[model samples]
Target: MKFGVLLDDHLFPEWRFYYLDYNELKRQLKVRTAANPQGKFAEQDEAAFVEILERELEKVASFRALKSDELERRVAHAQAAVDSILSSSDKPNETRMRAVEDELNKIATEMTELSKFVRLNYTGFMKILKKHDKHAGFQLKPTFMVRLAHRPFYKEGDRSVDSLVIRLSRLFDIVRTGGIRPPAVLPGGASQNFVRHTTKYWVHPDNITEVKLIILKYLPVLVFSSKGGKEFDPAITSIYLDNDAFELYLGRLEKTEGAEAIRIRWYGNMDQQEIFIERKTHREDWTGETSVKSRFAIKEKYVNGFLSGTYTMDKTIAKLRDRKQKSDKELDEMATLSREIQLSMLKRKLHPMDFLGYGFDHEEDIVRFPYAVLEVKLQNQAGSESPKWVTELINSHLVEEVPKFSKFIHGVATLIESRVTMLPFWLPQMDKDIRKEAPKRPPTALDLPSSSKRHLSVSPSVEVIIDRPSSVASTSRPNGPVSERTPLLARQEEDEEEDDDEQEQQKGKKSSDKRFPWRSLFASGSGTSLHIGAGGSAHPNAFLNSMIARENAGRTLQQQKRIVLPVRVEPKVFFANERTFLSWLHFCIVLGGLALGLLNFGDYVGQISGLIFTVVAMIFMIYALFLYQWRAHKIRNRDAAPYDDRFGPTVLV
Candidate 1:
């Protein structure tokens, strides 16, 4: 959809007047450009366009500032109420506690809307400016972008939003426990656990706010601050290193056993003196070892020298030892890691390939990621299950799971597309929007009042009628009565309700083609058996469709308590299987030769033993061939069944 239409669709009904006049600006540009028969605009025409653009920018800026202040006050008020309820000597009143919870919910909803408001207006301005530049043949975007950077509303990384999210999380935590806030986990606390499984998912920008609200109910946001303030910088910058062959990139992309990625990373900002030289090693589960990440911190001044093999970490280790800042074991480990990384860099001729994150001074290529990545790290005992909420969030429509997603690989693939032989599976998905229709959730105690329900019901894909008079439709739809123009909001609400009802009605209905479709696909070895549902039709790319099918199949297998292998089936895996088969055949040939020798050179008893040995040799050869073919078939079809044999080896012996 076009930006003009999308802007109108996602507009906050109560604050519609504050949005950019995108359509009007476009119409004005057309008229002004047409009057001048030449493509270039006259001085007066350019001035007129600039004047109108300035008005729109100012209007959006002022309104955003006003709304931001109002939201902050409301958050402070809610925080006070929460403290009162928590600090009371007696048990808090249930009604008061519920009221406080509702208030926080409203604040959170409004904050989300305000964020959307800022984003839509900023996008509108950019689109309109580009149109003006094209039609009038002027170079205005570069200068105007600088102007936009100075405006608070246009700054996409405004810290106020993060501050409000953190505060709301604390308040909601207090309300959830009825007076006690759960202990906050330090940012590095998860490192203490030796074994952890980290899964990454890409969150669509439209659903980021709602996703945060859902997670805040269970875990508090961890922030690092030097002055003990609520504000914290969330930026992390890293420079990935690789050779001209991109051996590290290929290794990491293929997920080869013992693949390693090297990078220099820093947190917060570029001015931070401390930097980490890190390496991530990938280990296959068949190796009976887990993947691990190791890093050692070094001063920023030594990075270039270290990479060039001029600086040694021995001096740094000695200084740390003398100061007693690190234990002897810790110093030794750091020294060993530093020496290994430096040697690897020099031997492999590794240099900077890509830069990730924000605000870097390097001359290397940098690519900004369009989507937010959420990493859920869990440290649980063996055979333990993930938390129910974590599982639910992963399955929800708000996020799309991209297993084994590597930032270095993505950066390299996107920045140096000409050099990359093959792109990652998730790269094709970038062209398509991952946002889906929000699922219908039952109302809870924290749900907003009826008057605010219309705001929550607006869908990103729903078309809203925007031609109505400003006076008649100033706010969201009312619950009491209806008017002619109000039907748009009413229809939206009704459609959502109808959707919920349809879902209820379809619970009992069954379709043979839809049930176990993945299983049938695996069994039949063809994509033709797959039924194209509305969701499947939306994603026309065959590769994306297959990925979705594999994910669904994996989820189903998980529900059945079965072992699941990697979804990606690389060609090397088949080669490995073939190699194993050849080894077994060689052993069988040796056994057959021994049986032949015994049969030819021995007496009757030796001949009888030779016959028995020959029979066993034949059985062994047959079993090995059969097992090889079966495993090859499974690997080709990308089956998720367990590959371990419980009785084959014992029975063969």
Candidate 2:
């Protein structure tokens, strides 16, 4: 059967145009054989590959069906033998039982091996089918069916078959969605290859919290979340390479914009397989042009060899050439630059200048926002260095600016501080400016323990150990000097501290009690609430219950506490109070009149409207009565003026 058009029409309609003929495939196989005698597929033609694939698939199916049936039969037979022996009236035979158990054990071991064999068979067939499918643009019928077909024969809840499908689905999702991109569009178009930007400041690590708070609003776009939901702001280790002459380091120190720094930076650990080698250059003359950073990754395995002067450029180029995934042009560009870096290291005798580490968190959908620290670095091909957005952001307190900050310089100074006599001649002035501008403690002087310290050796030839301070050494003391009285003294000190803490807590509790007026709210007095009659006293419980009920008094206590009209209130405030009650009275009368009018003349307005008017009238009358009582009490006590307003008028729309 010519499987060509039948499957190709459904799977890949475009395959017919580019599909290789059988003769062409045979010719390619011959050519490969001539080139490499022992290489895979060097001698085999297309027919041999197809035959092998078919035979493999057949073997997998036949073995699974036949072996599974045989295993089941053997296990069942062993079980039957044991059952027969046990059911018999004769005495149980130990030898027969042992033989039956041995047979059962052998079946179980074969079952495990069969399961693995079946899994491997499926995996191998799928892999081969996929490769051929890609070229032919048509998958093999049985292989495709095996993958897509629903397995009704498997036992319920058997997830063994489901795992492969789930894995494929996840891989598809990642390939479809996961790619490097900017969260938002840059000033220029998307085609820009490089963006130049400089650090306004490398913030003090002590102010990390403050800096985070400042940039909280911008973080939605600036930070990426890991699978564990942590904002990935990991410290990236950068090893700066410099020659013995210190020309690059000197130029950078002197603020020469043209000077460039070459470095390799990686996150977390140095044992990673991929690390970026970058050449960062700056230009001061170009307006708004801050810096240009070009970067590429090399294998981690090559890093040690390159540092030891064993790895050559030819080897690097050969590795690039072997990568079939990359294009010829890409390989050439990467190799050329790699060759230059390796050659420069050899000729100039480049050595490790410093190890710089900085944390960078970027906003989501980051197409390319490459910076070692929290500062922004723009890579625009146009070399546009205008930072209007950045400036506004800093001004808005999204981020604190650190002027003329370079991680390379900071790392060098901090690492070799004890060994070096004075700060670089130019650096002292910068340091003085920083100190003068902000006279706060900087975290640059942290005393880290030797075991946990992130150290960068200055030379590849020898490892340098920077000794930690005595304070740091003291903090990590594993075994303290023991004395007979030590445990007793420690217990005594702990007990004293606990007692002091308890006393402080008690003092605080007492002070809190005096701070708020709990007595005034629950107090039972004449001035505290409305009275039922002249010289009447009400209990606090009855008053609270009356307030909650908000209705006519039912109990004797509530009835006695119910407020009535009082005659001997202050006159000036009394008249104002009367006027306020009259206004509420007028409102109630107006609402009552409206309800009556709606009932008499507006039959067309509907029953719901008339009902609503009646309800409003009843509510207003009740509110007027409550206000009259509340105001009369306030006036009688002179607790608040009659003209004083507490609650606003309720307006119903």
Give the TM-score of each candidate: 0.58, 0.32
lDDT, each prediction: 0.62, 0.41
Instruction: Encode model 1's per-residue lDDT on 45-104: one tens digit a residue.
Output: 888888888888889999888888988899899889877876775676678878877788
TM-score of model 2 (CA atoms): 0.32
Give the least accurate 10-residue stretch of model 1, judged by summed lDDT.
Answer: 464-473
In candidate 2, how many Å is residue 617 off?
A: 99
Superposed Cα deviation of residue 7, candidate 2 (Å): 78
lDDT of 1: 0.62
Predict model 2's lDDT versus the native.
Answer: 0.41
lDDT of 2 by residue, 471-587 (tens): 100111232222111110111111111222146654563453343212122231111111221211222344334333542343344234321111223355656766777887798
Q: Can you tell me which runs of candidate 1 are displaced by over 4 Å? A: 1-65, 82-99, 117-157, 173-195, 226-231, 315-332, 355-368, 439-653
Model 1, residue pairs in steric clash: none
